[model samples]
Target: MRLFGYARVSTSQQSLDIQLKALKNAGVKPSRIFSDQASGRNADREGLNLLRLKVEHGDLILVKKLDRLGRDTADMVQLIKEFDQMGVAVKFLDDCISTEGTMGEMVVTILSAVAQAERRRILERTNEGRLEAKAKGVQFGRKRSVDRNKVFALKSQGLGATAIAKQLGIGRSTVYHVLNNP
Candidate 1:
C-alpha cells in the first residue's frame, strides 16, 4: 500500500515546515507529500485534489491534524466517508485517530460534530456583533477613495469623466458614479 501525506496552512504566510517534518518522520516520501497554503474553509485546494486523484485502493493518507483536512465538520465527515468507500484509509497524527476501526469512527463522529457546533457559534457571534455595529451607524464597507467634491469641481471645469478620473488618479467608473449620483 502506498503512503501519502497531506499538509495545510491557513495562509501563504504560514510555514509548513513542522507538518512536513512530521510527515517525513512518519515515512512518507517527499514526492508523495501534498500541501496547500490555504484555509481549510476553501475546498478547492489544488494539492488536495491532486492527491485525491492519485490515491488508489489500499493507499493510506496521513494528515497531521483533523483540522488540517477541513474546517467544516460535516464536510470533513463526508470526505472521510468517501475515502472509506474508496477503500482508502486516513490517519490524523496529532489527533491520534484513524479510519480503521469502530472506535475511530465513533471518535471522529463526535469530534467532527463538536467542531461543527463551534464554527456555528463563531458565525452567530460574528453576525450579532456586525448587526450591533450597524445599528450604531458604523459604516462597514470600503471607504470612498475619491473625493466627491473634487470630482464635482472638475466636472464644473468642463472636464469629462475620463479627464477627471485621470487627473485624480481614480477610476473612470468612480467618476461616472460620483457625477451620476450627484
Candidate 2:
C-alpha cells in the first residue's frame, strides 16, 4: 500500500516547511506529499483534488492535523467517510490518530464537532466586523478607477468599445458600463 501525505497553509505568506519536515520524519516520502498555499475553506484547490483522486483502497492518507484536511467539519467528516468507504486509512500526525479503528472514528467525530464550532465562531466575528464597518459609514469594495478623464477622452475619440477597453486596460463590459452610467 502506498502512503500519501498532505500539507496546507491558509495563505501564501505561510510556509509548509514544518509540516513537510514532520511528514518526512514520519516516513512519508517527499514524492508522496501534496502541498498547497490557500484557504482551507476553498474546496477546489488543485493539490487537494489531486490527493483525493490519487488515493485508492489500501492507501494511507496522512495529514499534519485534522484542520489541514478541511475547514468545515462537515466537509472533513464527509471526506473521512469517503476514504473509509473506499478502504483507505487516514492518519492525523499531531493527533496520533488513525481512522482505521473504532476509537479513531470516535476521535474524528469529536474533533469534527469542535472544528465546526470554530468555523461558526469565525464567521460570526467576520459578520460582526462588517456590520460595525457599515454602521461607521465605511465602504467595503474595490477602489474607484483613477483615470476617469482618460476613459471619457477615449470614449469621445469615437473609438470602438474594444479599442477603448484595450487602451484603458479595462474590461469591455466595464467600459460600456462607465459610458452608459456617466
Candidate 3:
C-alpha cells in the first residue's frame, strides 16, 4: 500500500516545516507529501486537490494533526467518509487516530465534535468581547482619515467631490459620505 501525506497551514506566514518533517518521519516520502499554505477551512486547496486526484484504493493517507486536515467538522467528517468509501485509510499522527477500525472511527468522530464545539466557543467569546468593548465606547474598523470639516470647507469653496478627493488624496466615496452624513 502506498502512503500519502497531507499538511496545511492557515496562512502563508505560518511555516509548514514542522508538519512536513513529521510526515516524512512517519514514512511518507517527499514526493508523496502534499502541502497547502492556506486555511484548513478552505476546501479548494491546490495541493490537497492534487492529492485527492492521485490517491487510490489501499493507499493510506497520513496527516500530522486532525486540525491540519480541516477546521470544519462537517467537512472533515465528509472527507473521511469519502476516503473510506474509496477504500483508503486516513491516520492522524498527532491525535493517534486512524480510520482502519471501528474504535478509531468512533474516537475520531468524538474528537471532531469536540473540536467543532471549541471553535464555536472561541467565536462566541470573541464576539462577546467585541460587543463589550463597543459598549465601553471603543471604536472598531479603520480610523477615518478624511477630515470632515475640510470636506465641508472645500464644498463651500465650490470644489466638487472629485476635486476635494483629489486634493485630499482620499476616495470620492469618502468625500460624498462626509457631505451626506454631516
Candidate 4:
C-alpha cells in the first residue's frame, strides 16, 4: 500500500506550504505530495485530477483538511464513497477522521452534512449581498479599457478591429465590441 497527500490553497496569493508541511509531518513522502493553488469550489483542479488518476486500490489518501478535498459535502461524501469502493482510504489530518470504520463513517457523514449546509448558506449570503449592491447601482462588470472616441477615431482612419487594437494596446475583441455597439 502507498500513501499519497493532497494539499490545496484557495488562491495563488495563498500558500500551500503549511498544508505540505502538515502532510510531511504526518509521514507522507515529498514525492507523494500533490498540491493545487485553486478554489475548492472548482472541481477541475489539475492537481486533484492527477491524484484521482494515480490513486489505486489499497492506497491511502491524506489531506491536511477535509475542505482541501472539496467544499461541497455531497461531493466530498461521494468521493469518499468511491475511494472506499476502490479499497482506497481517505483521512483528514485536521479532523483526525478516517473513512475506515463505522464510527468514522458516522462522524464523516454528520460533519459533511453540516459543512455542506454552511457552504450553501455562505453562497446564499454572498449572492444576496451582491444583489443588494447591484440594486444600489453599483457596477459589477469590468470597466471599458479603451475610450469610445479613440476607437471611433481609429475606425475613421480606416483601421479595422485588429489594426485599432494593435495601435491602442487594447484587445481586438474590445475594439470589435465598441465598434459594433455604436
Q: For every model in order, what is the number of clashing pairs?
A: 0, 0, 0, 0
Best by lDDT: 3
The TM-score leader among the candidates is: 3
Better-scoring candidate (TM-score), 2 or 3? 3
Off by over 4 Å in 2: 10-14, 37-45, 56-58, 147-182
After superposition on all C-alphas, the RMSD of every candidate to the true structure, in Å, is: 2.5, 3.8, 1.8, 3.3
Q: For candidate 3, what is the TM-score?
A: 0.90
Error of 1 at 96 (Å): 0.7
The residue-by-residue lDDT of candidate 1 on 115-162, one tens digit each, is 678778989999999999999999998997778999999999999988
Q: Candidate 3, which segments miss by more than 4 Å at Cα?
A: 42-44
Give TM-scores for every candidate, taking all chains together and pairing residue i with residue i.
Answer: 0.82, 0.71, 0.90, 0.76
Residue pairs in collision within model 1: none
Pick the winner on lDDT between candidates 2 and 3.
Answer: 3
Clashing pairs in 2: none
Ranking of all candidate structures by their TM-score, best first: 3, 1, 4, 2
Tell me the tens digit of each residue's lDDT in model 4 across 114-165: 7778888988999999999999999988886678999999899888889999
* lDDT at 67, model 3: 84
